[model samples]
Target chain A: MTADHLESRRREIVLAALRCFAREGFHATSVRDVVRESGLSAGAVYSYFPSKAELVAGAVAPILEALTGVLDAVVLDGVRSVGEDRTPTEAVAEVLRRIYPIAVGGEVDYTRVAVTAWAEGLRDPAVRAIAERTYGTVRGRLTDRVTRWRDAGHLPADVDAGALGQVLLSTLLGFVLQHALLGDVDLDRYATAVALLLPRG
Target chain B: MTADHLESRRREIVLAALRCFAREGFHATSVRDVVRESGLSAGAVYSYFPSKAELVAGAVAPILEALTGVLDAVVLDGVRSVGEDRTPTEAVAEVLRRIYPIAVGGEVDYTRVAVTAWAEGLRDPAVRAIAERTYGTVRGRLTDRVTRWRDAGHLPADVDAGALGQVLLSTLLGFVLQHALLGDVDLDRYATAVALLLPRG
Candidate 1:
């Protein structure tokens, strides 16, 4: 197969594996299941991913990319839209509103997969690296934005950028936990509560 | 066996299982491991718990009780201490400070077990019931306290009690997630960020 064809084939297998993991869970879904779901031979699946951990990492790559994309857009928009009379709180709230639907929306079950990955990360170093990298990337993006907001006088000088970023990220994480564990939440009310965390001008 | 003797034996087995789950993992640890850890025969282990799911529920029971006890204390203190000139925010912060050490401390690893339980809850209905009931109890207690605060003029009248409770719980949940994922957080900074979440008096 050509390089592009190989890459496409890998993507196809990873997507199939993700569906199985979401449906049957990481521990319950075996390589055979992935092969069955992908309609590919056992040899083909093994060639692409020798183990379930590698398959999980492959499946998770797209989610990390999508999450980082959302963070980048939100941070950039927060910076660019300041002149349009938008508050940082509004910007953060907008990010939550936009991301909430995708994180908890129908058919995809991203939260379940992410939660499973988190649990797996505790015992699996490979999965831990992926979880840590994703968290670090999100925290770094938030830290940068928070620093900018402080320097630009949008937030208080005493605001610890790292802590603020964590606080914000925690809100998002907390939202995911609540959604996954308890069912739907009132996003508007959640957004308002989050806004209360912002420094008032 | 006497009822008291049977109760103690059950506790011993559950503790052994908890250790295994904490050290290994829920999915990785099996009934055999629990039996080995507890130094009991397979028949004895089976007599006490029919399945791993039952063992998980048994293991999680104490943690839930401890959590609810903490919440009850915090909410009661938040109410009783109001007359002593402490703000509700201060009461909440105090709770975080007291709980932070225990939640993130070494050896016990409540966060890891909780995260594992959460992941298990996704695939197991019995575990899911335990997780949901614990969450509901905590949220309900928090909602009651928030309502009391608002009614007493400590908080704004318009604050949604349920949302505020959820936001606060999310902060705690977020702290747990961060601690479990990243190891240690600046609890002081986290406490300060949490204080900022409360309405300014």
Candidate 2:
């Protein structure tokens, strides 16, 4: 296959692997399962992934990257637009509104898989390292932004930026879990309530 | 085995099954794994739970019940303690603080499983039914309390009770997940930050 075709095929395998992982847990899913799911030969799957662990990580990497990208864009862009004039509550709300759609639908299954992996990773050092890297990078960036907001005086002086960051991250995650579990439910109003609760200038 | 001894053995099997499920995904973890983990014979394991699904649900039921208990206690006791004098924020805080530890540490692993199961259940009718029964009861109780709080003018007049309930529930779940993932990180500061965000009387 051409390089471009190879890349496309890789993406296809990853997506199929994600679906399999989401439907049947990662370990239960084998290379053959993925090949059948993706309509690829076993050789093609091997050429791309090498092993189930790598396939699981590769399958989830894009979705994780996308989530991290959205979080950064919304938080950073919101902060820039708010500048020194915006109240923390408004800034927080704007951030939530921008990210709400993504939180509710965009990567819901991916996140569920991520959560599952993190939980499982607790007992396995190798998997735990991957899970930690994935979580810490996203959380670390948010903590930095919250610190900047605190420095700008947009937030209350007593606000622990890192802690608040954790809360904000947790709020969105928990909502996604609930939404994923519940099928259809409006989350915007709930997002607004959380926004209202954040510390203001 | 006597009925009581049989019940004890069953509980042991269920707990073992949870650990196995946590280590290996539900599909990957066989009855053999649970039997091995619990030091029980396969016959003993099968006698307690005829199916793996029942074992999974039983393993998680206590944790779910505990979470629901906290919410119920918060609503009931917060309202009772506040009497005619307390503001909405204070009353709610009273309830929330009481349940914070449960969310963070009590039955945390099974809670993680419950969350994943809830998401997975969306497409699986059997799992979905169990999730709905467990989650719906929690949501319904919170909705009723939020309505009472709003009607009594303890909360913002415009607040959406059902949605707010979802948010609150999600917030607790998210907080628990973060705390669990973070391991050694001190979360007391985060709890304080959350408490500070509450509207003052």
Best by DockQ: 1
**Which tens-of-lDDT digit does each residue in A15-117 have in candidate 1?**
7988887776676789999999999999999999999889998998876777777777776664665545345455567778877676657456777887777
lDDT at residue A141 of model 2 (Cα atoms)? 63
Interface DockQ per candidate: 0.59, 0.47
Interface Cα RMSD, each model:
1.7, 3.1
Q: How many residue pairs collide in each prediction?
A: 0, 0
Candidate 1 overall Cα lDDT vs. reference? Answer: 0.77
TM-score, cand. 1: 0.88
| Highest-lDDT candidate | 1
Error of 1 at B11 (Å): 3.1
Clashing pairs for predicted structure model 2, backbone only? none
